[model samples]
Target: MQQVFFRLLGPPEIYYNDQPIRIPRRRSRALLYYMVSTHTPQPRERLMNLLCGDMDDESARRAFKTMLAEVRSQLRNIDPSIEWITNDEDRLTFNPLAPIWLDTEIFEKATANRQSNLSLAIKLYRNNFLDGFFLKGSPDFDAWAQSTRDHFQRLYMLALQNMAEVYETNHQLEEAITCIHMLLTADPLSEDAHAHLMRLYWQTGDRTQALRQYERLGKVLAEEFSVQPLATTQELYRQIASNANTLTQPATPLDRTVHPPDPPLQATAETPVVEVRLPYVGRVRELNWLKDQLLGHEHERSMLMLRGEIGIGKTRLLQEMIEGYCTDWRILHATCQEAESKNHYHPLTEALRSELNRQDIGRLELYPVWRAQLERLVPDLFYTGATDNTVDAHHNYTGFEHISDSSATLLADALVALLNQLATPQHPILLLLDDVQWCDKGTLGLLAHLARYVHRREVFILLMYSPGSGEQRLAALRNNATRLGILAEVELEPLSRADIHELVTLFSQLNKPGDRRLHTIDRHISGDWCYQQSEGNPFYALAWLETVWDQPETFVPARIQEQVTIQLGQLSQNARHLLQLAACQQDSFDLAQLGSQLGFTLATTLDACTELITQRLVVADPVTTTSLYTFTHKTARTYITGSMNRIERHMLTQTASRIADPEAIS
Candidate 1:
């Protein structure tokens, strides 16, 4: 499936798996939006009037045909397989089941599965439908858009209100406070929202803020309608103020309380020790599944593909899962890298060298021929005096030598046999291949061979990769493994709200018995801030937590910047330039307008955006669609913008401003 995304929430956007296609002409965009919104057949005359109100039948008909053609052509340019618009001579309708991703559709369908989708629905309602967009002259279209926007706005408000109540019921005062604040932002006259927010502020131990919120509400009411807050709100405010007064008293002067400092003790033989372990959170199910396999009586080899976005904590989770079993299990871990992808068996060689010693396993009676093949990977088996013959230095593929098909098979068999030796009943093997997408074809060949014997062995294979960045390299292997039921993929998603809180709480109090923490005292507030900054990616969340709040620039450190640049390096010059320009805009920028300023054709812009979008560097700005796209991650934008020299950055920003009204620039 191409995975079509008809984004109608903020500003109109259409995506076919990261390829964003926009109808260049205003009338065409308007026509497409109308049809897509209605999803019903429209009489030819209705559309004609919308576009050419005063034209003769023939002239209007010609105009309508041309507009429709442009829309169809634009959609076709991104993906030809999907017919976005279908019509006969009579009327036009959207293909609803072009198998799409629409937030409105998701919200509608969430009724069937309320608890699970409600949170998603709430997240998707970032702003009013088409928050700032207007079809200035098309009155009918404007009316339709306005009504539709109101409908979604009402749904969003209702959803947020319900969410706030749920949070309050669960005693999540900070979360509830956030929801109520959003509710008021959208509907400022909401008395219930103000009341809930005031109560929530009190519940969270902010008595001063609670009283201040009441004042703010009073001001808003007076400004809006020259009226006071409801009697109920005033009474509640009085109750809070009464409690505050009761709790406050003149501070009794401390009795010159400079208690004599305790005499310094003599130094002991050993300094008081405080050992701190790195904090871990979430992934209960994934951890339990691996533990089940580890503790089971029978071992049916399990090949798990752990995939997620970068910094989603794949490696961290792996460490947590394997830590307790280390004493009994022979855990061998190797990380494949992009630079060494072409080096034959590089990952395996590293793993073998780590776990197997030449003086130990290598000296054993593996078949004479098998031992020789193993020697190629395990260098210390035979004393070569530095005359390494495993790779031909002269060959283009320098690190690994090619062998006959039979010999490659022998090498795979030899490694499998070696693993069998290392693996014992008491010590089952856990072979971890991190960054599997970077694994060489040679390693894949060995893995394919090993997979056959794995089903009966006491070994588990975990291949970890990021789905967005390098998945395309192993699509065929992943597909085959899926069909064979040999590979099970467990995706590690971002932490939930509850999970984020747990994570923040655990680490904030690390190595402190008295609950003296490195994080801010209000755990709930700190968790909320972390969620906003990191979006629950554990690595990012932890990074934000560790950073000084005022020095926010340190959150996305140099390593993350290097990794971001590595990803950008893989894109074409067009894509890189487009990304640099988009990054300069701070948030989303108009793709068509930005490209036109740089003399980039629509096709060129789409091609570049498609690459960035698919790689998860940029996305159709999901915050109230502005027909603009942004760097998908805040860190990516931070890195890219910070990479440019100040003069270059300023120049690019000016260039991006040109897109605000390309016509003005023209």
Candidate 2:
């Protein structure tokens, strides 16, 4: 399979396996270039006009025929085994599946994925299209080349501006300055770039240079456009001059840790490898508290409820605590997924089965009554004559959802007894249940039951869940545990800016030494941007870092976008669109009015709201009588709104506003 790649963001070039393929004749090369760039068949007349328009019609026809043969001959020079050209009567086309490569193909594909690849797209523009490459007596070809050159330059300039904005937002002043310089180099009369350069210099403490930039902008505008700099630029210059004595620069300047080694497009042979491990940062105190609860100073068992917002590092904290500090303890862990939330006692049964298979519980002399209930959950753990019904030796443990009230009691009691027998101070039992908000009703019940005896036995139960996930049964269990004086709720909070900084440092150090993009990343991605972009969530921080690693110039993580996409994907298309429209609002929206605007019944809207809330994508606020709905997180809402087209969003807002009065407050 010969895959073709094109690179035409600069001078035309074709290569495969690092070997350049050439078309000897200028007009023939232009024919191949035209086909690759436009991906369309060329008619005989069009090709003749494009390549030999100065000659007589009969002579042009003969010249075009000669050029077509030359092109076919040149195409075969690379690989004679392949049919690289297709001629159907009068149309000339490149074989679609031919082993051909083009630089322009690479540029277009890289840039097609939004701003995420703008940096790579910008780098591909090595020079103007077909720089200094022109054929004699081909006016149409020259005209096409000039037009293409302008088109590519405009794309390159736009990409540079986008990169500058992203860098500016991320507080990478130096990188932003470089982008501005690139833009000005391409279009010296750009007043906006000059103005930005002035402001950026002011931020960098180059006050005198900043003032000079304004003067430079004025001269350029007067020379090119016969006008003065815009009033806004003049105003900015005045402000900088007037406040020179008391101007305060931005905080967290480019320190040694946040500095770039070289500019963009520095040639290097080695692929930059950023080694990333599962990052664990700023949970020192929480880890200690958890360890203290599990490995009590007084040898008393503890049940700690680890709660936080989604992606606040609950699961990470649990893993760190267990793997880093509790190697001596017998650990049994089971994570609950949303799909398994209703499978009776699924999480608890998993944890028990895990530990039981590791150790011989038969030697502990478990009671026949308790063992019988245990056998239903764990395969092959029964005595000679346990329950009335004989147990299958190879029975798989799927919790019985239809067990009687008496049977439920025995099962719960049997679970607690088995845990008690297994737990000892010498080898404390650390039973970990992650994402307990997804636990079944039976698992929740058993957890609540287990919580009561936590202080009495040597077992430590750890429960992790998101507080805002709307798990009512889990909430009830939490309340009951609090009343019983057995649960110590440990709520994890988002990381601070300092913590984000530390995390980035940790990530950078783990990268392969001499990774050139290391400093480029350090300089651009300040802790401030990470803190603000991720809202101090480590999960999002890691996502941002990973995005930066792939595209050293990007700050918006596709991972986070993919997550939001997956979250939205769980809803019906109509429901997702409704949610996106709702996201256009800056505050809670009246559900009834929203439903009315979307032509949905109140009941149907209510069901949609319930689904969104259940997914934790939206939250319902209480009004006097009616409930208003809002997205749970501003980030998720922003993502949804940002994904919507500007015109669509505007129309949605206009339609919504027309249906309701703005001054109406609850």
Candidate 3:
């Protein structure tokens, strides 16, 4: 059994037994590309719609049959032993029974296994997926081809970026420079790549060339976005201009160790452990509002939903509430895990277990019925010693074993009673649930139940989750709370520019006072750039700051790319793909244009967009028409664009250029 080698990365080429086989006819080639690229059993109707969309239904069916026959004929000529097409009553698919190796598959595998096979991955990405294979008269197929091309291109570019980082880490300056230059060619607006090229030029004793790169960056930025280079980029330019000779020397790793003197000064008293505090910036009113709620009247139970994007600092606000305001309250915090979303009542169970561990309860004297009910949730809470004389000590835990079979309402009521028992007039109970989007259904239901009755008790519940997460459940919870008139929703907005500056200043004071890098960052950093790049999100800002703190000359795009990639990794595959396409267009794009470019129907595209909007990956442009959408942050667009492959980018540019000047294309 000879294996057929199919290459879709460059030209659509095939080989059997190490001999080249031509796949003749553009339609036949398109059919093969569609099947191999999607790697799914495509419905007959979908194939007809994509490949023969221009034809009438009857004619399209005839044309589709003819194309399939041609495809099979081509495959047979390549290798008679191979069965390439599998057609059922309603679907057509590539036959996996035949021995075959696809370059696209191999490239994807290598890129996915990037850590171990970086070099192989870079080498395997010979060209974009099905390069230059346009299907005339089939707009849908063309759009699909363009999207697939872009996907592989982005993967290849990522491999190159990774390779460049590896080379630079290994001190291969020339190789690293080459990779940076290649990246710039694919993504000219990559500020980090431009900065890297400049740095590499300076490191290799070409001050003149390094300076020229800065001029190039200025021109590009001015011409393209009508904005100046980022403050970090400008700072790098100034540093190189002022100390060209000093920078040309090989960069020495900073000495991070501090050695104690041989005869250290004698300590008269124990050194006080000064608690470092990150100055709570921007949410003064919100924080004060929460404090008021926490300190409200005894009969008032408050349920506050703190909603924001992933890095917008809802957790930090929760922390501030705990440390700065809710000192007198007994805090029980539990964060839901994505992997544990299916676990029944996980967050509540963990919170109860934590509370139980915090307060050593020898017996359940106060609420024996509640104890028996909660024991079903956390059985270890009811453990007793033989010598113990506390109330209910002689009662066997087996008596509550059937509590697991109790109704959800009964369990929720018992849990509420247990919470009430824990709360006192002297110390209120503050229940903090973080990442509530990942909360188990049972836990959410319990929270919803509690929300209705919490106002009657001395409890303050703070539920924090990214907006659009657990939409149906959260919406139902909110609606129920609203109907009861107890729900208080507080949206955590991104930090203002001034707030980010204050945050940076506070971070510097607490962590690295008088550090030269900190001084430089304070002096030259652009508040607008920071705000835009981080979307005023503190987590992303802090991550970027940490990267720059270590290497003051680190390019901004690289820092942003690292953070954005980490975020994108957390999204569903469909949402991530949609975001990538949205990013390829300008920051703001017409919704219809995106759907057309991605070859998605309006409904499918809208569904993906809804997910993206919910996750805050992209937001609807309120000022613009409802059909227009924009990324949550400019940095996200930069990261997405920077990650695109050359061919994918070229296709986009070509499409735009053709649209702009139809005559120019001819």
Candidate 4:
């Protein structure tokens, strides 16, 4: 005899001869549900319509055939005599001639006998209907499905109350009280949960707190649900309040085992392969320093915060750090999004998820620990059970409360759990947070908290942020470090001439190593070139060198001059107008003042500064007394003054003249 059962309330466990089997796929499961729900054979067209309401005839027929074939294969495996197809003209019906034990059927049959079978029915309907199957915009189905689903939910609640009732009848106060707490956690708003908790509290000799729970529930219901307690719940509350005497009796044995239905089978998505190339030259000392900070130490927690202006090789430096340092550590990296900043805990969380899914720590014995930690980072991700969706859904984080809170104490706890599980002498943890400036508040707070205990633990966290951020904001962090005396700072300055030369040699593919011309150009680069033009910034210098090398013809001084001139010359007229306004004041022009001076729109002024950055003419120093644009090369500032036409020069001077503090220096 085949014993089929519906367990839909708790963890789903299926047993066939005490062996576990993978649940059948969706189409097969739906077919089974339909077959069990209907007494007669469903018409072929009707089945097709239900499965594919608007698909063309061929598609619907194909889907219907596939589902039937799958259903037949599964049933045949379990019982060879049971078949899905018995053709009656053009219609199809499932032929289950033998007696079948269906969960819903048993539930209905048991519920018919209120006194004896209610507990059995409650135990039978454990989880919600079709636990993991989502109905797509089918209102009628949703309504009908919800009614049945709620029936199970209601019965489960009653089962807990039944436990309480039986325990109370036996005067098993402790057991009954435990059930009440479980009910409350499952549903804080449950009137039954509140009433049961109140009764338990009173019985436990906490009568005052019990009365408070009632008062709290009254206020909560009034403000939120806008309703009084149900008559049955109120009666229970009154009975608890009125009675102080306890009755003692023998305990009744009750079976609490429940099995929720199987969840959907998930497919793992492909992960993007991230490749990093080590720099040919620059910051060798910094690279070694990073290695020491991240990998050299054997026992202490470590952290490094990489900070510099844009195009200053911060990212490149980090790439080098990862490549050269902490190979033994399980490294995880996440990047922040400018657009996603408003969304809060978006890209950071998503990045963490992607890194987790891509991890191949399967054989490391620390896999379970690592997985537990990863799940804490993204609880919803593991539930998907497939890589592609796991990675993709994280990247597309929808800003749910569950995901946002995952990175908090919960995430920390998970990480600690994972670490404890691994407890390896060799393996350590390394996490890199990119674009710290754009990180959400929750992530920032968690990191700060982690920083406190990270030294004691075997973890390293590295953060990279844009320079020139407010002192009030970042300074406090540094001050805290000093006060705690547990943190260190490494500031990155621009590359030296020798460093730049090494970089040029590393990236350069000159015809001859002994080429005098290459040497001549390298020699021409004085300290001023890096300090001003490159601003000691490696990326800026590299971009400059590349731009010079990519002329229409071979590199010539004339061509280099022309290219540089053209880039400096193409600033929007309004941008130049704003720049002149900025230059006239004490090196900084407030947006309103610049707007009024140049008659330039706020959008135009902002766009012009962005263009200036692209042209490498100005930099947006995010820090300092004022966040303003400045000439990339001081020499370029000189040219701006020298090359201007007489009228333009006069206009700039005139704009400068009107300011209260004309030379508004930062």
RMSD of candidate 3 to the true fold? 28.3
lDDT of each: 0.66, 0.67, 0.66, 0.54
Put down candidate 1 lDDT per residue, 181-257, tens digits, no spaces.
88778888766677767777777889899899888889988999899976667778888988854322111112211
Candidate 4 lDDT by residue in tens digits, 1-666: 756443433443444555654545655555566555443445676566556554688987887788788867766677776554577887676565644555655665564443566557656655666565644632333333443454445445555566666777788988887766655554567665676667667777888777778887788889997998666556655665776465222111121112122221111111111122325466777777777666554524355677755455666776565556545656566666445656645644654454443223232232222333344345443432211111334334442343322124334444544434433447666666665666665556556555666534466667766542221234555556556654556767778877766655654454257665455556664434434455565654554454433233222233224434545455777766666556555544464566666666778766776656555556655555675656655534544565568898887777777665557632
Candidate structures ordered by lDDT, highest first: 2, 1, 3, 4
Clashing pairs in 2: 5-102, 6-102, 6-103, 6-104, 6-105, 7-102, 7-103, 7-104, 8-103, 8-104
lDDT of 2 by residue, 1-666 (tens): 565455565567777667677767777787777767655455677767777868999998887788788877766766788877777898777777776556666664554454598888878889887887887877667766665575456556767777887898999999999998998898887666787788888888888988999888788778877988756667788889986554443221111112112122111111111235556778778887886776657534357788765667776676677677777777777777677776777776656655555235655544333544565676444322211113343333564766544346546667777777777767778778776767888777777877675535478788777643345658788788777777787788778888999987877776676765466576676777667677777767777676634453323465566666756766866577678668766568765676677888878877777667777677675443557777655667777767778898888877666656555522
**Which ranges of candidate 3 are over 4 A from the true structure?**
1-277, 358-363, 366-369, 385-406, 454-457, 508-516, 549-563, 570-574, 622-626, 645-666
How many Å off is the CA of 383 in candidate 1? 4.1
TM-score of 2: 0.50
Query: Once model 1 is optimally superposed onto the true structure by TM-score, how far is the C-alpha of residue 124 displaced, in angstroms?
Result: 78
What 10-residue stretch in candidate 4 is worst by lDDT? 265-274
RMSD, every candidate, angstroms? 36.9, 30.2, 28.3, 27.3
Global CA lDDT of candidate 2, please? 0.67
What's each prediction's TM-score?
0.52, 0.50, 0.52, 0.44
Off by over 4 Å in 4: 1-280, 298-301, 358-380, 384-391, 399-408, 415-424, 454-457, 469-486, 509-532, 549-580, 583-650, 653-666
Q: What TM-score does candidate 4 get on C-alpha atoms?
A: 0.44
